[model samples]
Target: MTPYGSFSFFLILAVLLAPTVILGLQGKRFHTYNMVVSIVALGIIFASSLTQAIALIIFTIWQVVLIKAYITYRKKSNANTIFYLAVILSILPLILSKLLPFLSVVNVIGFLGISYLTFKGTQLIIETRDGLIKKNLPLSRLLYFILFFPTISSGPIDRYRRFNKDFELEISGEQYKLLLYDGINKIFRGFLYKYIIGYSINHYFIANLRFIAHSHFEHHLYYMYAYSLYLFFDFAGYSAFAIGVSYIMGIKSPENFNKPFLSRNIKDFWNRWHMSLSFWFRDYVYMRFVFWMTKKKWIKNRNLLSNLGYILLFLLMGVWHGLEIQYIIYGVYHALLMIAYNSFERFNKKRKWWPQNKLTHVVAIIITFHVICFGFYIFSGQLFHKGV
Candidate 1:
């Protein structure tokens, strides 16, 4: 059963969360209960495929061992080689998962949520290397954080420190009630977005458009918009469900979307769209790259460094989606847009040619929206399809 995909899954979730609700309302900590539920839920999620179950088990064990070992070593020394090795090992499974399929090899190591789980592991390793996680975390806490079933598949990628704070909090009954209300509201929104609107667009508009001659420009145009909307609603809806469930369990997983379509620029759109993932890339990948380059004096020109960072960031993001040609093109396409927009912004700042007003803001939003939709079109692989 897919997570958050069916009535049965929701029914089971309700049943499982009943104890959590009761405990929380009584102002009791439900960490142990939640952990148990997470394990059980994971078991159920991977039950249909024994291979995937084994893969998940092995993956979890690998991460646990690696984290513990790294933490132990980190206390004794701060070696750059060791830190890099730990980071590489943390992401190795995800790398293999993405690469093996392209090599026409059966992916024995890949499983659902491998990418997100790898992010969690890699984050822990990085923070440990940076001496942020000074205290030795317990095995149970580590397992619970890594295997938290709510945001397992896709994430608003919670940080270790933030998640631990929530896990250890002792909330009042009044606060619990508020959290419960918010959780239910977000779940309702999820249903409306994913089930009602997203489904309607995919089934009615996108499906019908596919039948009306793919070579037609109008058909492709209609599809681009329909697909862009569908992608947002579907993903945002899933994120809502994940975050809401996290709230009910007393962890406020971060928000992933914030009116992305209304963004006024490419950078602004990224800040508002799949925010957690984009922010993850920005924080972990782009920032690190820039800092390293600066420290090494590899690229002295700030603009040149920033442009290169954008290229690497988007390309890595694209490859993360898959090793498809369209995905790579989509990444390069966005990189160019970002560079162009940055240059234009710098030029306009000096000249003050573009007026700062409601009309300009609206026009920018409109232009940015189209730019994003075209990127989505590339991401959809529709342009690469044979008949198109």
Candidate 2:
């Protein structure tokens, strides 16, 4: 019953989406219907495990109470301690989920999509603390936003305000037609990427690399490239499916990938690859860290602070993936890459040494691509697992 993983799921999805399609094509709002469908879809998704389903319900109730309490408190005052507590409580479940395995405890607090749901809840609390969200959100709307089935598992993490805008939008027939076309197209592309190309690469290429390669170096190198490509297609494919479903339901979930492999620099690559997640870390984590440091007057050198922020952000992102050594190393590796690239860019800017021509751009792309693939290699954990 994995999301976007089977024919039965797709069949169910088509049936559930039928009402949304009918309403959307008629230039009407389908928010209520969509919400009901989301609940049903979530029920089916979690139905495989009764414990997980109970976990989700308990998690949802915790979030709702916390958010309501915070909103009420926020109306009277904006206390730092209370805000911090709210944020921590919002993420406590996810933190526990990540830490429980290390302690040999069964994770009763964990369920599918907890990470993403925490992200949404935490963002809402942060925004409320910042006064961006002045009014208390409706419980139903909050639940809908939290439980939106399409991007619930993994996300092009939608912000509370942004999602609300789409939820409230009234699509015209013309607009709906365009959205319908685009949604279908994206779903088709996802099929090609995931079912066809990604499958072929994994089954035919990556699976056979060990037999074909004569040496450890060749085998690892080929695996790195193949794995990197496989990851892109597989993840990008899932993103497309989620976003496409969102579009059909009139939500317009953000795009997650661009021409990531063609990126000319590490920074450029981050801006393109897994864009939604990168931007989320940039906006909520890195930017906030820099702002807090500046406000506290802890560091005067902006560049030094920025570099530190990158380190913290990536490390958190890595730890978010899991508490694995390879994930941590992957984070540290990317932080170093970003810091090194920033220094190089500054040096090049001062000297006007790096040419910005078509040829150089292509060369840059090649270099950046290899660098990224190597990072993916670290992320894949093969270096530690296989001793390669």
Candidate 3:
């Protein structure tokens, strides 16, 4: 029962959340209800078709065992080699999931929420290694953590600690009322965004995709705009519904988008768009790469080090999307843009005559938006793409 996509799902979820809200108003923690509802929702989804469901179950069991073992091991020793091995074993199934399709096998290991869950599990492993999650987690609680449904399929990924904090909070009547109102409003807004305008644009794209694919050189502005809007509204709308449902349940899930189109630069755009995923990449991949390089004295110059990090991070981002030429180009394109932007900033600082006013800001916004739109064109696999 996905919270973001369907009217019936919301209706059903609203019924479940009603009792949860009632408990919260009585100053009680509804953690058990939340966990049970989440499990039931996923159970209802995958019960009819147990193939994918079995994959998810196996993956979950594997992750649970790996994390539990790691916690046990960490209690005894923090050996770097064993820690890395444990991390690899935890994510090995996910790696198989992504690669098995190309290996001419059915996607038996892959599941809808695999990537997001891996991120959470990987974070727990890393944090446990760093002494953040100090105590060992029981199997049941860890299952609750990994299977928390609202952000499962597509996430404005919430951290384990944050989810626990919200789970334990007792909402006042006033706050509960406000949360109910805001949550309903957000669900309605998501409906408008995902179904109404986003679907319209998506339909338009489907009708014209073949046309654009055939016509080699005619610039299709409409398709570009349609796809961009569809992408934003659909995913952003899903995020809104997820977050809204979470708020109603007193979870206060992290936000995913924040007026990304108004961003003045590529960096600014990332800060606003699909923010949870972007920040995850930055925090885990980019920052770690830079720190390692700095610590090893591999690259003394900071800017060069940063540029290298950007390449590796975005390259991983591309590979993560898929092993497609367009996806790879998309990642490299952004990496180069960021590198050039950094260089330009360095140069512009020396020459202070460059305009730094409202007009310049407006101009920068326009340029950045177009740049992003062009990138999306690449991402969509519509530009010079060889097709049947």
Best by lDDT: 1
Over 1-388, each residue of candidate 3 has an lDDT whose tens digit, in order, gives 4445566777778787778888867766677888788887788666666787898898898888889888898999999799889889877987888788867888878887888899889888988988888898867778887987877887888787887777667677777778778877887888888998788778866466766555634436666766787889999888888888887777788989999989988889989998988888898789988998999998999999999988998888887787678889999999998898888888889997567899989998999988988888888888756642
Model 3, residue 307: distance off in Å is 0.6
TM-score of each: 0.98, 0.98, 0.93
> Cα deviation in Å at residue 287, candidate 2?
0.5
Off by over 4 Å in 1: 210-215
1 or 2, which is superior by lDDT? 1
Better of 1 and 3 by lDDT: 1
* Model 3 vs truth, CA RMSD: 2.3
CA lDDT scores, all candidates in order: 0.93, 0.92, 0.82
| lDDT (Cα) of model 1 | 0.93
Clashing residue pairs in candidate 2 are none
Poorly placed runs, candidate 2 (over 4 Å): none
